[model samples]
Target: MNFSVGPPGLIIAAPRSGAGKTTVTLGLLRALRRQGGAVQPFKCGPDYIDPAFHEIAAGRPSFNLDSWAMGEELIATLATEASAGATISIAEGVMGLFDGAAARGRSGTGATADLAALLGWPVVLVLDVAGQTETAAAVALGCARYRDDVDIAGVILNRVASQRHFSLVAPAFDRINMRIFGAILREDRLALPERHLGLVQAGEIPAIDQRLDALADIIAAAIDLDAIGQSARPAKAAIAIREAHSDGARSRLQPPGQRIALAQDRAFSFMYPHVLRQWRHAGAEIVPFSPLADDPPDATADAVWLPGGYPELHAGALASAHSFREGLQKLARRSIPIHGECGGHMVLGRGLEDADGNRHEMTGLLGLETSFAKRRLHLGYRRARLRIACALGAKGTEVLGHEFHYASTVSTSDDPLVDCWDAAGAEVPEQGARQGSTTGTFFHVIDRIAI
Candidate 1:
């Protein structure tokens, strides 16, 4: 469906990571929603985590707009689609506004600035002004003048000390003509606890609504809500996607099976929104089952999809889950194609060692050994060429994805499932494993290299 009206949209970005962009973005989403405004939230880049929080805050599903993994047209189309009926769309920027995958040979390949420039969205910059006085204003000035394409509409000073601190930074920003929307005082409660994969999943966090409401109250008291609303410039008119215009080898996104039984529990929640959406768009029925509740895949389904999530955290429960294990094994014996990624990949292995160094028995479908106890952070943007005709793609089909996990592979005796590389196309040795009808990889697919 086309957006009859081009909705007002803005990008909430920061000078760097740990600069309170997520907190401010969540706060603003809740605050705006409370004021009877329909808010659409989006996270830039190939992140599965932040969008979950965005959804919880805005009471609507959030989508990703990746400048690296996704094509420019897809990004624009997704942006328009995600905000169809919303009053305003707020996109939380990835990393620094201008910092993209510089090694990828494209300006703004993974950056928020690229997405902002593409959609002509004004940027509401969040500056974590903890210790700095006038220097914080200097940073904002530099960012505003850095790129002409990205319009830095306003600045929200986060973690300010007091009236004296705000006074010191306020004059400098005013002098440079950089609009300061609000100043948030230093508050420890505004921060969220994080794991190796960024903040713990929104579902796992207890009292999540209360936490978001507290953050919203903080923003409502400090920030200029009307100013932020007014700053969201309308996005460009929606354009017809290339897939619609041409009949070339476009991404039809066939579902792995006609009746796809998706493992959609707390343990397997990292499914990409676009692919699931595309599968439905292509006439596939998605049957969801909860592995965390010790439930099996819908027995009538043809294929099984165990997406990536925090399986390591619940390894004990999974190791003892007879219904899920026995049911999945029955499917595997019937030659049903089952695929896993990251955490799901770990669950598919022979065993997984938790952070406490306790080994838990996993489904022995693939000859792989994984351990989170001996954690090794493997984080990167990946480009994969499938070595076999596996669940991911056909032989030699290339896909753009990312690997972000704290689990280390202890052993992988089976043949490599995918010949993988970092975003720059340099070879990454022995990236994944495959057996009979089972395939597992640490890399989470964003899209099949946006042909």
Candidate 2:
């Protein structure tokens, strides 16, 4: 059976990080939703936060489309699945349009440009014209001319000082025949709060719906919604590839268990939507429990998964959760499969030292000890080959994932879980640990090798 291309979409990108891509993307999503359009939102990399905010604005779940960690078939399949029955899809780009991993990936550089070129979608460049005026056009022109495959459809002048500022920038784009879709004046209230990782997760914000409504009001008044709608194009190339390789394209990461107990809350909220979606699609059940609420994993669960999040912020409370701690121990004794990633890995350790240098007792399922007191950034894409049989896969199974955390491991005595390498194919120290039924790593798995 052949699968057709899904809805038309546009990629929201910028010249660099913090160039107002999120703001423009969120505003456009809410604006289009308010106009009665069914908008599907997606993120271009291994991000968990922006997609949450995108969900709120679009009233739909957002999926990550990582060109580096995921294969072309998986990326295209995810985009096609998520865009079904939507009027348009809006993918928020990661960093700059061309910035990506240090080395080339299975696709390209894992850049927003790669996704754009792969899907045949047009890019709406968001230019932060705060410091300069006409020079912004030069930047857009550089991005547009940077690659022959990636199409820069139009430009959005963000953080403009005033009508005068926009007037100066508008003429430059017109001279170069570049479309100026919109000009949003500088508004401090429009900015989202940020922490060490990225924007504070969307759920933490109070009255977030009101904030999105206000954003939609501003964007609908400024941006040309009609023009943007007209510029979108379906993922024709991606759909064709999927159709030609229909049999092999159906592959997805195997679910950890039949009844997976997933830890979820503000402290452990970084689980990938696509992962869970695939699990459900495969007929696996997700039983969610909140460690922040001191809730234990369901007794009927055959396996437990602890996703990464901001456990450091709530280390004190977690230390006092007797029930959650006891439940994990019981599950491990039952020989049930258990896995953790990043913050979850930290929580499974014997102890965790918060930023204040206060040590808190954890589940102690593994011998690992972690510390946020002397925080060190561990951020990169990883190629992991499991050393022992676990929920992730059989021993020696390779998986693609990423490690993004600031916690340092003070100690660990358990056997290593995976032999790891960086995106550049250089060998890194072995990562993760396994003891009996429990296994964990700072790495968050994205997809398994296709065998």
The parts of candidate 1 lying over 4 Å away from their true place are 1-5, 105-107, 238-249
Q: Pick the candidate with the highest lDDT.
A: 2
Q: How displaced is residue 236 in candidate 1, in Å?
A: 2.6
lDDT at 282, model 2 = 80
Cα lDDT tens digits for candidate 2, 225-325? 99999999988653454443454444467888999999999999998999998899789999999998999999999999999999999999999999998
| Model 1: lDDT of residue 295 | 93
Clashes of each: 0, 0
Q: In angstroms, what RMSD does candidate 2 have relative to the true structure?
A: 1.5
